[model samples]
Target: MPKWRIGYRTLKTAIGAALSIFIAQLLQLDFYVSAGIITVLCISVTKKESVRASWERILACLVGLIYGSIVYELIGYHPISIALLFLLFIPTAVAIGAKRGVVTSVVIMLHLYTIEGVNVEVLINEILLIIIGVGVALIMNMYMPSNEKDLTWKQVRLEDCFRSIWKEFASYLRFGDNSWDGKEIADAAAFIEEGKEMALKNVDNHFLRNDDYFYHYFKMREKQFAVIKSILPFISTLDRTLIQGEKMASFMEELSQAVSPGNTSAYFLVRLNELRNELQQMELPQTREEFEVRSSLFYILHELEEYLLTKKKFKPDPKRTKTVSAKRLNRDHEQRDTK
Candidate 1:
C-alpha cells in the first residue's frame, strides 16, 4: 500500500486541482475542466519554479488570448488560422518570456476559436479561471516539509564516492597496475553535479533565507577533484620505488577514512605540509630521470595541499546531522535579527 501511495507534493497538487475544479464548476465557468488541467501543469518540484510556471502560463494566456482573438476574427476559425496562430503567436510568447507556456497558450487559443467569438463576459471568465488555477497552486506550494535530510543523504553518498575513488588511486599507486576500472571517477563526478543541483532546488523550496551548505560542500569537492584528476597521469607512470610514491600511497589510504561531513581537513592539511617540507629538504636528484620523477612528486604534494584546503572552508556542525537546512535557516534569521 505504501508503495502505491502518491508522493506528498503530487497528492497536494491533485487536491489543488480538485478544489479548483469544484470552484470553477460552482461558478459555472464554460471550460471548468481547464482549471484542473492548469493546476496539474503548474505543480513543480519547488515553490520558486511553481511561481515561474504560473507567471509564464498567465503571460502566455494573455498573449494567446489577444492575438488568437485577432487571428480568429481575421481568418474565421479555419485550420490555416490555427497554423498561422501557432507559428506567429508562439514565437511572440517566447520572446515575451513564456516559452514554458506555449502549450497552455495553444489550448487557450483553441478554446477561444471553438467558442467562435470573444466578448467581455468570455474574457472575464477566462481571467477568473486563470486566477483560481494559479492562485490555488501557489497556496498549495507556499510551504514544504523540511528536506535537510535529503541534502545530508546526498552529501554522504557523494563523500563515499570520493573515498572509493581515493582508495582506488591509492591501490594503483601501491601496485603500479590499472586493475581497477576508472568508472567510479566518472560516477563520483556525476553524483557531485547531481547533488549540487538537488541542493539548490532544496534551497528554493523554502521561503526562509537559508544557506545551501551542501551545494557549497559539493562545489569545494569538485574543485579538489579537478586537482586529483591532474595528478592521476603522474600516478599512472610512477612505480612504488620512486620518491614519495609509497608514502603518498599510505597517505591516500589513511585520507580515505576521514571523507565524511563531520571530519575537518586540518589533519590532512598538516600531514601534506609535512610531506611537502620533507620532500623539499631531500637531496637534489642524482640523475636526470630521477629529477623528473622528483619534480612530479613535488607537484603531487602541491595538488594535495589545494585539495585539502578546499575541504577546510566549512565548519560542519554535528547538530547539522538533523534538520540541517532548517537549522541553518534559523541561524541566519537570528544573525539578521541580531544585526
Candidate 2:
C-alpha cells in the first residue's frame, strides 16, 4: 500500500505505457497519448487479467468507433451527437460487462469526433493504434517474475507458527504453569488469516482446489487452534496430577511435529484412540469435585479427538488403501467362478 512499494507489475505497466506511446508515434497515429492511456489501463496484475482487459477494451473500441462513425457521418459531429452516442453506448457497454473499457472506448469515439468523420482510412488507423497499445500491454504481462517462492516461504512460516503453538499446548498440559502468554494464540490466528489472504491473492485462484487450497488448510488449523484454547479451562480448573495430562502432553508433542501438509495424521489418530482407551480403563471418580474434574478432562480428550479427526478427515493417508475389503470381494468372486 506504500507509495514507494513499486512492485514488478508497476514497473511492467510504466514500461508498457512508454512503449505503447513510442509505437503510436512511430506509426504516425493522430492520438498517440490515447494509446499510452489505453496501455496503462490494459496492464493488470496478472497475465490472464491483462489479456482479458485488452480483449474487452478492443471490443469496446470497436463499439465506440462503429457508433461514432454512424453518429458523425449520418447525423453530424456536434455536442448533441456526442451526448446521444454516449447515452446509447454507455449502457450498451455496461450491459455487456465491458464497463471497465468505458474510458478507452470514449477516447476512441472522441478521436472519431475530432476528425469530424470516420472514413475507411481513419477506421484502419484507429484499429492499428488500439492493437499496438493493447498488444504491448499483453506482452508486458506475459511473464511475471515468480512470487511462488514468497508464497512457499509464507506457508512455511505459518506451519512453523502452528508447530510452536502445538508445542506450547503440550508444555501447558504437561506442567500446569502460567509460563505461556495467551497473546500467542491470538498471534497464531492473525498469522493464519493474513497468510490465507496472501495465498488466495496468489496466482492460482481458479485452478487450486481441495488439497491445493492453501487458505483451507490454514482455516482448518485456526478452527483446531480455537479448540486447543478451549482445553485451557480444563487445564486450569482441574488438578493436573489426577488427570492423564502427561499422556495428552505427549500426544500434543507428537502432533506438533506432524503438523506439515505432507504428514498424514494416522499416527496422531492412533495415539488419540490409545489415550481414549487409557482414560476409559481408569476407575470412575467417586467424589463430586473429583467427578467434575474428570468430566473436564473428558471434555479435553473429546475436543482433542475432534481436532485429530478433522486432520485425518481432510488429509487422509493417500498411500493407505481399502485393500482388505477388496481382497475379500476378490476371493469371493474367485470362489464363485470355480463353482
Candidate 3:
C-alpha cells in the first residue's frame, strides 16, 4: 500500500479508539471496560508505524500494567490515590517511549482508573487484556503487512546527493563564464551539507540492516561525495584562470552537457579519469595560485566524472529523444523571452 494510506490508517485507529471511549463514557458505560477493546482494534488496524514501534508500544503497556496493579494494591480507594498513581506511572512510561511517552502512559492509567476500584483481579485482567491486544495486533500486522520492505530510503538519500552535486556543477559552469550567481554558490554549500548528513544516515542504515546491495550503493555514494568535496574549494580559482579560460570554457561546456540529461556522450568520464591521473602525477602546488589552478581543474573534472559514472550505470533510453528535444526547445524559448 502507499505510504499515505498507511498514515491514514494509523490516524483512523487512534481516532477510532478515542471516539469509542468517549461514546462509552457518554452512555455511562465503564471506560476501562471498553479501553482494552479499543486498544486492540487500534493496534490491529494501524499501518503507519513500523513493527519496532508496535513492539515498543506493547512493552510499554506491559510495564504500565505492572505499575497500575501496584497502585491499585498499595494505594487506598480514593480519586487522589489513583491520580497520585498516575503521577508516578506516567513519567516511567515517558522514559520508555519518549516520543509518545506521556500519551501512552495516560492511555494506560485512564483505562485503569475508569474502572471502579483497582484490585488484584482487575490488575491481572488488565494485564491479560493488554497482552491479548498486542498479540492480536501482531498477528494482524503479519498478515496485512505494510510496504516497509520496499522503502528505499538509501536510494532517496543518494538521489538528493546527486541533485546537490548537479547544482554545484551548474554553479561552476556559470562562474567560469564570468556570470556566476553568488546565490547558487551559497545554496550549493547548503545542499552539500544536507547531502552529507543523508549519506551518513544511509550508510548507518545499510550497516545496521546488513543489506549487501545497499552497502555497495553506499560505497558508490561515498565515492561520489568525495569527488564533490575535492572540487568545491577550487570553484573560485576558475574565476581567475586567464591563461586557461578557453580550456575552462571547453571543459565546463562538456561537464554541463553531461549533467543536462540530454547528452549521451561519455566524454566527461574520459576527461575525469585523465584529470585524476594528472592530479596523482603532478607535483603538489606550493603557492595559492598554483593550488587554485590545480584544485579548480580537479573539482570540475571530478564532478563531470561522477555525473558520467552515474549516467552510465542508469542510462536513459535513446528512444526518449523527443523528451530531450522538447526540453531544449523550451529552454531556448525561455532565453529568447528573457532577452
lDDT of each: 0.81, 0.75, 0.52
Best-fitting candidate, scored by TM-score: 1
Query: TM-scores across all candidates?
Result: 0.82, 0.78, 0.52
lDDT by residue (tens digit), candidate 2, 1-339: 757788787898889999999998998888888888888998877655676777889888899988888878878989999999999899988888888889999989998888886788899888988998898988887756654445455555556666777787777766776787776667777777776766555543233332245556666777777787788677776665755777777777887877665545677777778888987898988899888877877898889888777776565233222332244357669989999
Worst ten in a row by lDDT for model 2:
316-325
Quality of model 2 by C-alpha lDDT: 0.75
For model 1, where is the 10-residue window of minimal lDDT? 320-329
Superposed by TM-score, candidate 1 places the C-alpha of residue 268 at a distance from the truth, in angstroms, of 3.5
Off by over 4 Å in 1: 1-5, 143-145, 167-187, 314-318, 321-339
Question: Tens digit of lDDT per residue, candidate 3, span 98-141?
Answer: 33434554566666766746667666655554444444444444
Q: Considering every candidate listed, which one attains the maximal lDDT? A: 1
Q: For all candidates, what are the clash counts?
A: 0, 0, 1
Arranged by TM-score with the best first, the candidates are 1, 2, 3
Better of 1 and 2 by TM-score: 1
What digit string (tens of lDDT, one per residue) describes model 1 on residues 31-116?
98888888878888888888999999999998888998888888887899998989998789879999988877777778888898
Error in Å for residue 44 of model 2: 1.4
